[model samples]
Target: MSLARENRIDLVRGLSLLVIFVDHSNLSFSGALQHSRGFCDAAELFVMMAGMSAALAYHPASGAAGFRATASRTLRRSFKLYWIHLLMLAAVVAAVFLLPFIRDPALVREWSLDKLAAQPVRYAVEAIFLRYLPAELDILPLYMLLIAAVPLFFAAIDVAPRLALAASVALWLLAGIFHLNLVDFSQPKGLWYFNPFSWQLVFVCGLLAGLRVRQGQAPFAFSKPLFILAFVFCLVAIPADLVIHLGEYGETTPLRFLISKTSEGPLRLINALAIVYVVFNLDALQRLSPTGWLRPVFAAGRNSLPIFVLGEILSDIVTVSVFGREGIPLALELLAVFVGVAILLGFALHRDRAKRRRSGKPASSLLVASQPEPDYGPETTTEPPSIPDARPNTAT
Candidate 1:
């Protein structure tokens, strides 16, 4: 089959990164653009896209370099993420500690790291083990763990097309039923905010969808009835889940499991899938113009890891800058959001240009970021695409 690569994933991933910065920046104007308007947020999108990107990057086709080599590379990428997480953790901690202007406790309260300053050594150790998560930073360790498990997921793929998916769902059910989670060091009986046990279900689903893409097919067959149902569900969710009755995970609430972000709540997962289906089936996303208004967005998503790291720092910088202001001006909020996005876009484009330069490839149009690469087999080249390979996460 001729490869029909889709650029929608990059487009959506880039959009999510933008949303993440705006949301985390805590700018008052972010409510309109951030994921708070939905049941699931950018974190969910990034994880699913990460799984899809993993399939593209490390599928057996790429394994012709030798499955051993591929496995080693994937694991190495995981370690690289681990080290980067640590560095980011240190930077975040130091910034919070050393910044004199950030005197307002409320400004830094979201970090939830009151104990960290007192015991840096101990917190560092816990962080190394994927514990002691601070706000906005927990996703890194989760990504690190998931990337490290790619080999196992690929193994299940080899065993049976649906085996991994089945196991993923079963584990998710078990986790929800038993409240399974990795240890959290911040408090007694604490657990990771986004539980990998439950979140794996979505990642595995994305992996399966990507497998279809690798074979030049759409991720899901279109069903008009299903589309209508998903559309209705998403609309209802905005009001029921995000607006009215969007309560916390209160024990007595009927929507307890639905609101629990840690367990990848059932309603939230369904909402995420519903939205994805509606968007993907509409077919508009398939024909996105990479060089159009979203050119910067595509660039940011193409080099997501670096753009993401930069965005987090920028978010904190903005939050700190406005700590004591009586009220955040709309102008500063707008500049923070727009300029932060521009910085990320520039960084992503720079990384893309650097890669093209090093490879001695001619400069590419904006299409370079969204070009669909052929999914090759053994007869095809084993070299991974420079387009954000799950490995060498650096766009280069």
Candidate 2:
């Protein structure tokens, strides 16, 4: 299998990071990302892309030694994510407690940290175990669980892709049917906002797609009929959501059974895959990706963990600063997005420079076919799989 790297994933993933910041900021500007216009949002893209990243990084393990090596790397990634979650909380805490500019009482409520006084020990333990997700911090726990499952999932893939996907779909169905999810003290129903069991379907789909790419094949074969169907599905979905008033029922809406984000309703999954297919087939995007203007996007995607953490912290800051304010003007929203994106890109570029310096190479634009990557903490290293990671595709 060819070991070629596709920089498009990085570009798309980086774009998703920016969209995520916009979505979580609670500012009216969040609508600019077209999430309200689509059946799926950046969260789906992020999770599925994460699956692909995992497959690319840790799949195709062979003997015991190779298997252990893959496990070691993924374990480090999961552990790094866990501590990074806590570190983000600590940073938020330092800001809330130490910074005199922070006078809003709602900050504690927003972050769901208000109960630390009543049961500090219990809360701390739950947070450490990734059981108690707070506010926007919920997604990482889902990611950690998925990463931890990579070894077993890859094993299943080695035997047969169908087996791995079938098991994933079964688990998703069971989870949705039985209301299965991890406990989150912050929520009324004691469930994570992004349920791992429900979301694994999308992750597994992405894993399969990544495996295809690893085998030097297209993730999804191109066909006129499939492309037309995906486009029509996307085109009709917006009006469909409006017609059903999908989320209007809040918790008990029957339509929620088909479009629920928490449980990753069937429509959401289909729409997400459809979008991936359509976007991947966009020859224009692929052609333009190598342009010099997209260097920032490449950098941000390559340094995703750090960029994501910083984006979250910045979102919190933006949300807090605008708390209790009158409506945020459009001009102000544009400025916030501009500044936030600039900061995130700057950090990414800084990391790239640091990496180049360490590698003893003249600093240059990355994603020029080859470059060394150093995560914000070297916490995302993925060694190539030595085994037959995936069988060649003849009937994608």
Write candidate 2's Cα lDDT for 254-274 as tens digits.
666777777888888888899
TM-score of each model, paired residue for residue: 0.86, 0.86
- lDDT scores for all predictions? 0.67, 0.69
Model 1 over residues 242-267: C-alpha lDDT tens digits?
Answer: 44233433344556676567888887
Q: Model 1 misses residue 53 by how many Å? A: 1.3
For every candidate in turn, the CA RMSD to the true structure comes to: 5.7, 6.9
lDDT of 2 at 245: 44
**Residue 284 in model 1: shift from native, Å?**
1.7
State the lDDT at 319 in candidate 2. Answer: 80
Q: What is model 2's C-alpha RMSD?
A: 6.9
Task: Give the poorly placed runs of model 2, Cα more than 4 Å off.
Answer: 1-3, 31-34, 97-100, 242-252, 324-327, 360-396
